[model samples]
Structure formats: C-alpha cells, structure tokens
Target: MSKLEIHQIPVLNDNYLYLIKDPDSDAVAIVDPAVAEPVQEKLDELGWRLTHILNTHHHFDHTGANLELKEKTGCIIVGSKADADRIPGIDIQLEDGDIFEFGTQKARIFEVSGHTLGHIAYWFEGSDALFCGDTLFALGCGRLFEGTPAQMWHSLSKFLTLPDRTKVYCAHEYTEANARFALSVEPQNAALQQRFEDILALRAKGQPTVPSTLGEEKNTNPFLRPDSPDLQETLGMGGADLIDIFAETRARKDSF
Candidate 1:
C-alpha cells in the first residue's frame, strides 16, 4: 500500500488544497495553497515541517500564499517553466515530462494546459494519485481562460494514457454542478446518471466529491466523452469533428 498521506484543505469558496506528506522521508508539500493560515495551522497540528509548494499554474488563487508560506516555512516553490515569471517565489521551474522527486515518491509532470497556458499536472506514478490543478475536474473542466477548446481537449486526453485506477485530484469541488451539465448532454449514460445521483447525495451531506478515478471519469464525464454517441446526439453534432463536439459541449456549459 502507498504510504503517501494527502490531506485536503478546503479554502475560500470551492477550492481544495492538498497537503501531501511522504512517509519514508518526512517530506511535506502542499499543492496550490491559496491561503497561508490554514496551511500553517495544519502544519503545526501535524508537527510537520513544510518542504515544498507545488503549483500547477499562475492563477492568483493558486499562488497567493507562495511568498508568505516560503518566508514562514522556508519552503521551496515548484511550478512550470513556461509560467515561472508569474509564479511568485518559484524556485524550481519544470517543464513537461520532468520528474519531481518528493522524498520516496516522485511525480511525472504533464503540461496539461488550457485552464491556463502553462497549467501542469503532477502524476505520482507509484502513489496512484494525480494532482491536476484546474484542468480536469470531477465531471467537468476548467473554462478556457487563456487557451482554446482544442488545447483543453488535447490536455484532457492525456489522462486516457494514465491507469484506470489513478485518482484524479482536481483543485475544486465542482462535481455536483458538473454532473448536472453532464447529464443534460449524456442522459442516456447509465453510469453518468448514477454518478449524478451519487454526487447530489454527497453534496447534500456537505462532503467532497473530488478525487474521482480516471476510469470513472472516462466512462461518464461528458467533457471527456464528447465522442460518445449519446453526448454527440444530445448536442446535435452527430459524427461532428471531435473538437467541434467538445467545443459545443463546453460552450453550452459556459452558459450553464
């Protein structure tokens, strides 16, 4: 069993920050820290020293605490080389395919852009975890803020290369609303219907619905299933260009 401990810290209206600890070496890292206080409090509670800060993009919410946390903990910050100029206090700039060693566990970086032009995900191979910041969500994707539908599609498609059981640790709690859009586009998908029900129940109980499995997302997420017949038909883009189908679905969701 993997001993990589990940603690979820919810902050400021729907954001999820991951505090990850590697058991073998006491290496601790927090992914996309928006606020400094909660992270610092958590560190004190666990009596663990923060070592690194992992950022997937240059968004303000993701990098807000970079300076404070670095000064407070003397933690090194890691981010994409392409967007290093925007990432506050970034110490190690990495590009796609680079390996980031975290104590005993390591993450293979995948530059999954489109949420932001330089957004990247850290796929911890042996840990069965993917810290995908804002590119892919539970059932939806990030809006095309600085990239195109084609870029987002290409970015999301990389997840298909990952193992079925890989846990997708996206940076938000958007599953319930994303499910509504997914069902509207692919109502015929039994798996998606059931997932929607499950999402509603989870949200109703004030629980998180993130970290959905790659296999489950591939089987149900409409954004990931643009080529599926039901979703295509629902969008009236039967046999349309794959990107076109995805674009239309995303357009509709933008208004949703």
Candidate 2:
C-alpha cells in the first residue's frame, strides 16, 4: 500500500487545516493554513520539514498564515495566479493542469473557481487523495462570494467526475450543520439520513467527521447531487439544471 498520512490541524473555530505527509520520503505539505502557531507546533513535534504551502483561494481565513509559516520554514507558497494580489507571498502561481511534487507523489491542480474567483483544488492521483479546501465540503459547499451559480455548477460537475474512491479533505468541520440542511432538502433520502446518524454518533463521542470519500459525498451531499429526482422535485424546480438546484440549495442554507 502507498504511504500517505493526512493530519488535521484544528485552528480558529471549526476550521481543519491539513498536513499531507509521505512517510517514506519524510516530506510534508500543508494545505489552507489559517493560523501559523498551531501548524508550527505540529511540524516541530513530527520533525518534518515543510516543503510546500498549498492554498485553495485568496480568502484571509485561508491564506493568513502563509507568510508567517513560510517566513519560519522558507517554504514556497502556491496558489492561483488569478488571485495573486490577495494571497500573501505566493511564490508559485499555479493554473489548471499544473503538476507539482509534494513528497513522494505529485499533485495535479484543478481550477475549481466557485468558492472564490480563483479557487483551485489539488488532487494527488497516486494516492487518490484530494485537498479541496472550501470548494467542496463534506455535506455542503463554500458560500458563493465571487463566482456565479453557473461557475459553481461547472466547477462541482468536474469534481464529481473524479473516481468515487478519492478521499475528500475539506478545510472546515461543517458537516453536522450542512447535514441538517441536507435533511430538509431531501427528507426521504436514506443515504443522507444514515450519514447524519453516523455523524451524530461520532460527534456525541467528541470525534471529527471529516475526510469523507467522494463516493460517500456523492450519495449524501445535496450540493453534489442536484440531479436526484427526489431533491429536484421537492424544490418545486423539477427539470431545472444542476446550477439552478445548486443556487436554490445554497440560498436555503444561507438563511438556515
């Protein structure tokens, strides 16, 4: 089996920054760091040298820790060129189809510009791991702050094409609340109900319900399943495209 370890660094409320490590090579990469202190402490504990700083968007909550962390480790900051002005100290501006090595594997960058104007997600194809930041979440998606409904639609559509087994590593711990909204939209969805129950059990024990696979999200995540006849009909917008359903679901959650 391939050796890939993903660490969740809880920072600033429920946000879960990630540390991607390769045991064999002892190389480490951090994704969407919101705070530097916690990440620095973890790196010291693991005795791992930071190699790359992978950012998903230009939001301060996501890239605020970039300069501080890079100052300490001298690691290169990688983010989308379109948002270069917003992301601090971005040394390497990445675009779609760009491939960069993290440790023992390489990550293919996909331009997922919905959550933010220049948002991008990293896919480590060899290990079937995805560092999606806020573009794709466990049971929800990021609020559309920059892009339009159509842009978000096309972006999520591309992600749904990835292999079902790919593990999704989102940047925050918003699963429980998102699941609640999901239940409202798809009341009879057995998969959604079962997942909500499972999450409740985990949280009841003070556990983190994250790193859900693409297959699980596909079955349960409403934002990703706009084509479901049940959900489409319930919204009173049957025959509407994925973008229409996505917009409606997002609007409902905004008020929820």
lDDT of each: 0.92, 0.88
Candidate 1 local lDDT, 78-186, one digit each (tens): 9999999999999999999999998989999999889899899999989899999999999999999999999999999998899999999999998988888888888
lDDT of each residue in 1-256, candidate 2, tens digit only: 3657888888888988888887768678789888899998998898888977889998878988999889989988989988888899999888888997766688898888888888999998888888888889999999898888888878888788899999999988899999999999999899899999999999899788988999999999999989999899889889987788889988898899
The candidate that wins on TM-score is: 1
TM-score of 1: 0.98
**Please, what is the TM-score per model?**
0.98, 0.96
Lowest lDDT 10-residue stretch of candidate 1: 1-10
Model 1 scores a C-alpha lDDT of 0.92
Clashing pairs in 1: none
Model 2 residue 215 lDDT score: 97
